[model samples]
Target: MPFESIQGRGATRNAVPARFNLPERLVEGDWLDEVEALDGVSQRRTTITVERPKSILTRNSSPDIGFDRSINPYRGCEHGCIYCFARPTHAYHDLSPGVDFESRLFVKPDAAKLLHAALSRPGYDVAPIALGTNTDPYQPIEGRFRITRSVIELLTETGHPFTITTKSNRVLRDLDLIAPAAHRGLAAVAVSVTSLDPAISRTLEPRAPAGLKRIEAIRRLNDAGVPTLLAVAPIIPQITDHELERIVAAGAEAGARVAFYLPVRLPHEVAPLFRAWLDDHYPDRAAKVMATIQSMRGGKDNDPNFFTRMQGHGPWADLLRTRFAAATRKADLGTGRLKLRRDLFRAPEGRQMRLL
Candidate 1:
């Protein structure tokens, strides 16, 4: 059966992995087809589930990425980016890594409390807590739940340093909190812009803010004295690769101090989902895109090694790096890293500490 692209959703199918032994879902009878024929495909409304986890801070020892500790106020992003590497995480809950990973969302309402508890520990180490590492902290639900705002408030009060990476302009809504933190050298923001063309962006990131809005957000954040990094992440081969230089120049025009790019990574479930997406939307060039990606990835769908994973291997990868460096230089956007200050961190006064 051919996978049909869902309107306003990224994944072409909602498929559960075989490792979980979950039964495959199929519409039971012809009645569904009759209803669809009459009324067209029904829209998939997003469902939010509140999760109260014991810990809010996730610590990682991976040497590939910069930060060691991070916080994700939500799981399963609704932005519906088909290339999201985090999609496979949905499998742990016996859920499909495809559409279910985007529609069946989870928010941590108690994230602030958990963060407070973690920070108040006697021997808590102070390091930058990365937000939006696994799932975007500023996803649409944050506007309703305010869980991410609460976490940021707690961090701000304690003078702890953190970084935010998001594709939404909604981060501007919390500028009151973030501006002060940036002044204290305790915060920075990275805005990810996948494509400048609205049409390409619509299908590539169905629910994310348009590229122009995100670019404007970079300008606003910079005007507020917040150091902004423009991230042109997951630069898909034969898809949005042509816009690399234009994106960098736009970021520079918007006052982003630094810029970076990553090649599209198709690890685990993301591979199949992205392939399906290409088949549906770009059938004419899907094979070419995948072949170019494989050539860059050393003839594999993805490279799992630490260093090579971030920087793809082979000729195409080298060319991408060269182009990125040249583009950044041309745009006057520094390739230097943004360092968030951790010296100003103050542990929240715990109950036992109050007695002292």
Candidate 2:
């Protein structure tokens, strides 16, 4: 059967239902048509659709995470990191967490406006707002949409404190605004650098900026007096894990004040996609790599228990933590901790306005 689009009168929080159970392949119908039948079919270009969320600040009570609120200006990141945990979120929009997650995207045109409204409420609490937590705020689409920049502008104007995490150097474009905010302890940034090997980074995070460029971004941000941190995230075991020390050292040399690392996490659809990527790229060592991952993930493809999920469990996980701690000390990075100034936050006046 041919695929069809389903439309609803109004968007709902759970509006888009996923069709994950559909057959993986389809065959052409036997209609007795000639070769010319396919000759005139022109593919339609997919268009971007904007979805205005009623509210933007996603609140979390999970003790394992540091931030209580975050703002993602866009959905379905274009960065196309195969192992991205946020990919499965697209399923809620009736979109595939694979290709559609990257190609078919949703932009929140009213993010800044919604944020202002929320913050203006009498009971609104001012805490460091996290950006780029779910999907990258500075992904390639940001260049055109400019939603992330708009949010930053609002935060700067309101004298609100915020933290950003990104894998792109494109963030530098807004340094003019970020630098001043940093001067007031209202802004800080973390750059995610998965691997120093350009080739590995190319395949692992196909659309993200190169590893060196990210490091350079850290150097430049630090030079501008921003509290920069190097996030050696998702340090895949037996793969990029070997480069942990090298990454920390490089970030230290780049003037990063702090360094953090997260062991690879494979949740929901991300598990299968990551496995496929592993099979395609490192067929020879796929088994060994997965074995190492399982060792860290409590002998399973994933470990979902609170704190354990972020740090992992078992001997292998312990070893990773020990190694990371040692590397950070050797590199003269943070003595295992870097703190952001929370006392500097001030509530911005006025209701949040929407960005058209």
Per TM-score, the best of the predicted structures is 1
Residue lDDT tens for model 1, 194-303: 99998888888899889999999999999999999999998999999999999999999999999989999999889988999999999999999999999988898998
> Candidate 2: misplaced stretches above 4 Å?
1-47, 335-347, 351-356
For 194-263, candidate 2 gives per-residue lDDT tens digits of 9889778767786788899999999999999999999999899878999999999999999999888999
Total backbone collisions for each predicted model: 0, 4
**For this target, which candidate reaches the highest lDDT against the unseen true structure?**
1
lDDT of each: 0.88, 0.80
- Model 2, residue 114: displacement in angstroms? 0.4
